[model samples]
Target: MKRICFLYCMIFVFLLMPNIVGATQSRDDGLSQFMFGISYNELLDTGDIRSHKAEFLAGEEIQGVFEEYDTLLYDKKNGYMELHLDASPCDCPGKITAAAYAKRNGGYLFLRNKETTCIYRHVNGIVASEPITSYMPVGFGLQMFLPEHFSLPKNDEAAFFLTAEIPRQGTTTTLQLKQIPFGLYVPSTTLLIDDAPLALADKAKEVEQINDPQLSLENGSFYKTYHNIHESALIFFDPEQFNDEAYPTELPKKELQDMLLSGNLSAIGEKDRHILEKLGAYASSYPPITLEHMSERFRFFYMVYQVEQNLVWDTCTMEWDSVAGRFRITKKWLSRKKPASFLEFLRDADFWVAAC
Candidate 1:
């Protein structure tokens, strides 16, 4: 009787083991889904290519806010700035409405809502023209033009303040984000946002645990310059039409390099040519910057291109050029792996920037 009971117990334990193991794994997978980069295709298509996975979550009161790039491209030339608020990734309880403001005198009542407009427009990448609202799969993006005759704020100040309101059941939750980069309106007070959400104490703890470097880089000088260069590159090479055969022939390789050095953007096609022309004209104001005279901080931007475009061999020996007073490429071997994109090339060269 004892032997028979032991056998039965063993069978029961074996039957339940798979269920226990599978349940834990399923929960882990679900948690990872909310982590980051799961929406890369969506973000990339919409030109929100910031890959750093810093996430800001709010408790049950509001769905989470995910920023692809901590920074928005500041288009000094066009006088209009755009932001993509991705609420699609979050689970919403109700409708979410937002407004922009300029912080002044410890309150957010300076800039009136009438000065801003939420319009659906995209220069390139994913076609997300829909204004951001609750429970949408595609997410929301808006462009706000600077008030007429207002100049850009002095270096690295908050352009304006953004406030998000979430109405759940009978209660309404108001969330504010601070210290955003350059925008049209200027506030008397700096708009540095406190990372900790005062509403949800528990969720704010989770946000505090994220130690992403991109958080700091968002406001750094290198990042700002990198964004300008990277976005300008996209304008010149519009990734959507990049694979098109006729596109490459439209601009010669030398001309493309010159464009970068001179900070000029040439319109490649009829699509959004006007914007391209504006960008081109604006970029032309900067004097020519050559690799030889490029700053050490920005040298990686040029080196990545050299390794991909100018390198003849997969491997090369650097020899000191006495006359040039710099390292010169001597021998070359075939690269073991070829990168499909500029970001991939940067990684392959082992000179990766956090933003990339």
Candidate 2:
């Protein structure tokens, strides 16, 4: 009986050893990296790659190289696996080296330069020929990495690539290819806005303000001020600062102003519309008010109120830009979902309202 028990213990130890070693190896491997499809388009098509900066850590260095562009071959290499890109120059000098690594779990690229690193995931396809013409001016730089993990697409075959046109005099020996795994996806988690009913008086007052004409000027000062005030309100109400007492029946004017100015009001709920309506009315009734006044004011207020009530979630914020006359909402959690306007927000409200 003693011999049988000892054999069972040995078997269990043998089975567990591989798992322990694998976990340790994975940790040491670092985080994954890739060039997203969007980044490629922006860098190659629009020539705006420089605007998207990358962050680099100390003791890390990145260099660029030039190479012949071939779309079919590029697609073949990247289509099977998920790819992401960090940064690229608009043009390369000669024999541009497309720097990249195998996408793995919990892997990242670190650079010796202390620069910001912007990552892009590979979507599909590559340029068959270099985008820049010979002798034409081209920008070239390397994206350095910080010691952090980044999310990679799930498919294993995809690879992220970045190219830079290096002058004939450029150096290639500095380029390094490292392999790392994709990291866990972390959502932009936030507190849910409390849903409570709005006050009657506040609602009536906003309706009244909506009828004011002077404030609605297409390009008038009041219109601008009204838009600015509502814009400020969104900033003030940050969901992160919510405590039990933060939402009360009566909010002071100064408190509301503070919230608006702070640009933290990303999570105000519809049940809280009554308070917002009252606030809008109060703003409209200020000195130099006119009939056209409340139109733009009311429009902007309602837009924000609707956004807070209907679109905003724990992981995102919805807002309208009066200057551009468009609604914009962002959900970092739903990476695939594109940024939407007010109408788009309503049309796709169901997609983002889920609890993940």
Candidate 3:
């Protein structure tokens, strides 16, 4: 019985040894190791060109960390590997030539600048190169590649890094690295205004007005009218239209004459009128009507009070024509305004600034 028990124990240990060894090997191999690249296409192209000076980095830990990937290939030559960097000007145009390199050993990579000879190591696929002292007519940048065998460092994490160096009248170089989580996806949704579905007609009209090819005087009549109304609280006056003494007077007397001819103005219903009136009243209170002074407009200005942050202030302006029973609201009218309670609008503007 003792002899039989000993033999069974030996068999059990043998069966478990391979799995234990495999686990240890995996830990040593640094699973999910990260690698970064500037652009994949450039790296692949570098590989096709067979440029020895260039290199490529590959590992599993790199994903969303690098913003772009370079296209390059690796070929083994006499117990070592050589990278080929080639440039095709038609597709990609930019300064700075970049490449990534890695050896079979897990140690980090160090790059030496030919001129300055300053050395830097690759940190999570980001390597900062020394400044360019030599004068080159063209630009230079880095191109990096990521290997497929590498996996994400985490389930859904991403990171990015950017660097740029431009010499006076010499070559300009830029490098960026990005890593993202594995198997990530995002869904699209319909855009809404004032908690209501945006009308396709209005959207189409906006697109047409923005992209109209003709640059004639009539083409921008409505836009010009809107700007004048916002700045002076009046229609296109004599002094605003043109400086020509022969045609000093305003050209169009009717409210919709020039706008209708320009295909920018259209008929509106009572509901639209009510909305415009409310928006106009809100916009008239703000000052500094310059284009850069406007704030981000909200569909429901009142709802801003409910947000946790007090950054909901906005301005809304509209131009009303009592004679024609028509009005127009300019995009600038839907901007945010500073509140008097926040120390003369200074504090309020600071609150609304988005985080970098």
Candidate 4:
């Protein structure tokens, strides 16, 4: 009888352990290295060549000007990956590297890598964000992103540890983000699985909802009881801090800002031009514009937003620009799903075009 009672208690204790364990997971300080990684199954699982996938957005387009540079390629053998996005008019250099390690489960692998992340400073202090290209490293200095050296595991099924040292700003070791209520932001994870072919996992559920609209650490965070994300409440950058207008004196006089909002692409600094061309392949879906024709309706462009599966999602609300001098268009990301004014469109883009 005692054995039976003890067995019942043991089973009941086991059932409650998951919730107890999950509650104790360590949270993060407001400032920690931000990273994303994809596992190479060929190196870890079966000996098969699989094509890993990733997406990027180059945020600059000048009239008739195209810059070229190397785009990040996902290597399946050693699992090295890189992503670069620069909108800086200054000649700045930045680089990030990535690699993969074996997960204990054996069926899956955990990615370990770090890259540059952003935060906003409004009024008194710094507000954490998922790093936007609103500010670029000015002048010339090496932006060293490699934390530490790592070696690939020779045995596909073996577990190993490698040393890495990623740097972060500020005095505090804790990772914090603005706009998000405390305790929601947790450590992030990303994985690319191998099925019949390689496939990307659903991030929200798989990675603890770091990308969830409600969990956003943006300046203007929004919450929703329904399934829909509140587009109006989101804010990408503080307008006062990150100016949206083009300063004539700051730009070169080689070409008219017209025909293109940024003038000739060649007019931009050499480093910027090179980065533009590197990310040029992604320009098709959201191409830069030259100038506004009378026949054309919208001023700037935006990548259409969708809830999932790349389906078109948006509603349109007209907004008029009164200052209207020379109408020039650049490849801007405009979401069509929720009809909103120019102000609201920007707010929505702030979250959509974000990094971990």
Tens digits of per-residue lDDT, candidate 2, 110-169, equal: 111111121211111122112212111222111112112322212212112212221122
**Winning model by lDDT:** 1
Cα deviation at 288, candidate 1, in Å, is 17
Output the better candidate (1/4) by TM-score: 1
Off by over 4 Å in 2: 1-211, 218-221, 232-237, 241-247, 250-278, 281-337, 340-356
> After aligning candidate 1 to the native by TM-score, how far in Å is the CA of 174 from where it should be?
57
Predicted candidate 3 versus true structure: per-residue lDDT over 45-114, tens digit per residue: 4333323333323322211211233332222121111112123222322222222222333221212111
- Give candidate 4's root-mean-square deviation (CA, Å): 24.8
Give the per-residue lDDT digits (tens) of candidate 1, residues 17-38.
Answer: 9997765422112222222224
Off by over 4 Å in 3: 1-39, 42-53, 56-218, 221-226, 232-309, 312-338, 341-356
The candidate maximizing TM-score is: 1
Name the TM-score of candidate 3.
0.18
Off by over 4 Å in 4: 20-33, 36-81, 86-89, 99-356
lDDT of 1 at 188: 27
Q: In angstroms, give how far residue 176 of model 3 lies from its true place.
A: 22
Model 1 segments beyond 4 Å from truth?
A: 1-219, 239-306, 309-335, 340-356
Better of 3 and 4 by lDDT: 3
